[model samples]
Target: MSPENNPSSGIVSQLESWAKRNINPLFSKDTWITLGEYIGLGRPVSNRPITTARELGSFVSSRSSHVAQSALYGYLKTRAGTRFPELFENPKMLASINLAKWHIYIACISDLAAYMGVLLHLRTGSDNDKVVRLMSRVVDDIVDEIGMPDEAGDDFHESVEALKIRIENMDFSMHEDGDAVFSVSPDALYKWSPIADELKRFDRTPVKNSVRFRWKDVRETARNLFDAQAVIESFGEPGSSGSA
Candidate 1:
């Protein structure tokens, strides 16, 4: 079937439209600057009225990087309240747990982007080299903005390769909603092992498994966050007022 008529492609297009309309504005340059100013990261001296690119990038990273974890936390609080009561009751502990898993969350987001990139490529029948280059560029730009750890670049590439293999084996023709492709258990990118391990430390096996089963919700939230970042980056350079 042509991509236009394909259900998976349709879902991707719908997601893109929704993201542009709803999520993009949140990552605008003006929004970043306003947030920076609110948190005292802006205008420390009379000479500097506007937030610099580095400052803006840092602020955006600090806030946006937590989007997935925030969604997962809220999900656990509301839907799995009986199993993860501390998530709702102990803000300090929750903060500590999230901080500890910050890098894992970043990895998960990166992996999901790679997975989505593969899906887009499959749906569009794009030139493989061009698609790979575009995906790499996007990841590089995000890494430049967020500043990953020394080994994160390598780890991300490995995860991308793993996701590519998994996608190649999947039968997308059998799926109706493209989003359902992402809802499979034992996330293809292999980043979820760390997250599951973290949860296992505090909860019993069944609770951990239950939380793991909800990875799709966390993935969807991360995808939206990624979409917002992509939209903001498409406007202009990261910190320029034009990006607003």
Candidate 2:
């Protein structure tokens, strides 16, 4: 059966559709103003929108990781009582769970970098050379902003480089529909899974399956969220400075 008709795929598609629609509101200046007010950051005196590549990078760095983590947590919590009943009972497995979280976090970052690379290319009308350089700067900003550990940081960089090469070779003409139509291939998704080592070492089948199964959904959701933010950043309100 086609993905749209399949039960599992339908649910995921619905969620993605909902998320894409809602993400626009989340990037609104008024949303940030209310967030700032609630968080005691105080209302900003100005609208500091994300315009430059570095700014977009920093924005993704701050937001993507958290979104990834939350996605994993929600997935696990949803499955804890059914597919992985042991998750709640086995406190000893917490370390493995945390490891999986970080692994997925880095992988999601890599995926987002590739998607953002494409977005930059299409939106800015930049060539591959400029796209790669801007993407590298974005990655650097993310790594520095997150203060990732040395080992994980290295892995993150390597993963991003590999994906960037794949993106560079892709037929971007397919993206005329815009960022929403862009998607990483299943092969690329499989290759990018960071949990293989964890799965081998932990012997926790439930956690392993959980990580693998939910990965594609998580990556797609992150892309949608980032695309929403990128839209606003690439072309702000009608008369704003960032608009095309």
Q: Which candidate is the best by lDDT?
A: 2
TM-scores of the candidates are 0.37, 0.47
Cα error, candidate 1, residue 36 (Å)? 16
For residues 1-244, write the lDDT of model 1, one tens digit per residue.
9977654454444434544665433233333333232223222212221122222233233433443344345334444443443232355544444443444445444444445455435555555554454444445445655454443434544544453454334433343324444332223223333235555445444433443455555444433433433332343433444332
Off by over 4 Å in 1: 1-67, 75-95, 148-244
How many residue pairs clash in all the candidates, one count each?
0, 0
lDDT per residue (tens digit) for residues 1-244 in model 2: 8765644444444434543655432233333333222222321222245555555665555444544454455445443423232342344554445444455555555555666666656655655665555555556556565564443434555554554465445443345423332233222223333334544344344444443454455344444444434543454332444432
Error of 2 at 92 (Å): 3.7
| lDDT accuracy of residue 51 in candidate 1 | 28
* Native-referenced Cα lDDT, model 2: 0.46
Query: lDDT scores for all predictions?
Result: 0.41, 0.46
